[model samples]
Target: MKFLSSLFAIAACGLLAASVFAAEQAPQLSGCAAKRQDITTQIENAKAAGNAGQQAGLEKALSEMNANCTDADLLKQQEQKVLDAKREVSRRQADLNKAMSKGDPEKIDKRKDKLAESRKELQDEQEKLEKVQPDEDDD
Candidate 1:
């Protein structure tokens, strides 16, 4: 019984170490490579689920990414998204201010919600932009 328990414990430890090693060995993809991987994963899922329309769309998107998706272009697009998000946040802030000035509690609450959404979008865009590191050529 003691021998069996010892073997089981050793086996558990080995499995845990193997799992950790596998996770560590997986490369952390970023930029266009990461984007490609994501789209590919989606395509595979769509295919597996028998969603022909979605699979076709994902395939088209993957092809487009393959053809025209460059690191520089991706960086520029992410920057533009961040800029647009910022503009949207500013607009929402103005709307909220207007609503507050009118002293309408309902409108103020609605505008506040809109402003929060825009702010969150801006934050998400900023995070995405950070993930896309610019090449030296971009500088």
Candidate 2:
């Protein structure tokens, strides 16, 4: 009886562990894949409803998503580029601050130009990132 009870306890613990592991393994959708699925569904629904205008728009969106989100590696690279751009902006801002502290007109102008360039780069990178990421509304 004692041995049988111990065996049951061990089995119960094993089952509990397995359940916990399974629960922890949530399904993660690939950015492009999810978008593709969503767009496909929207396209089908639009076609069913005979909404030609909406269908055209959804098709265009789907094509853009396919172009941007298909390559996971490219998406990751774009994300990295955005991070680098943000860092560059921060560095440029620091330089501008230093120039301001020095009270030199020429230095301040140069730093301001650099800062503008950095900000533009950051904005471009952010746009690229947005293209690869899943839209919040899609979720």
Best by TM-score: 1
Model 1 per-residue lDDT tens digits across residues 1-139: 9999999999999999999999899966668998999999999999899999999999999999999889888989999999999999999999999999999999999999999999999999998888787545556
Model 1 clash tally, residue pairs: 0
TM-score of 2: 0.48
**Runs with alpha carbons beyond 4 Å of true place in candidate 2:** 1-70, 136-139
* TM-score per candidate, chains pooled: 0.76, 0.48
Predictions in order: lDDT: 0.91, 0.86
Q: How far out, in Å, is residue 84 in model 1?
A: 0.8
In candidate 2, the residue pairs with backbone N, CA or C atoms under 3 Å apart (3 or more residues apart, or in different chains) clash, namely none
Model 2 lDDT on a 0 to 1 scale: 0.86
State the local distance difference test value for candidate 1: 0.91
Candidate 1 lands at a TM-score of: 0.76
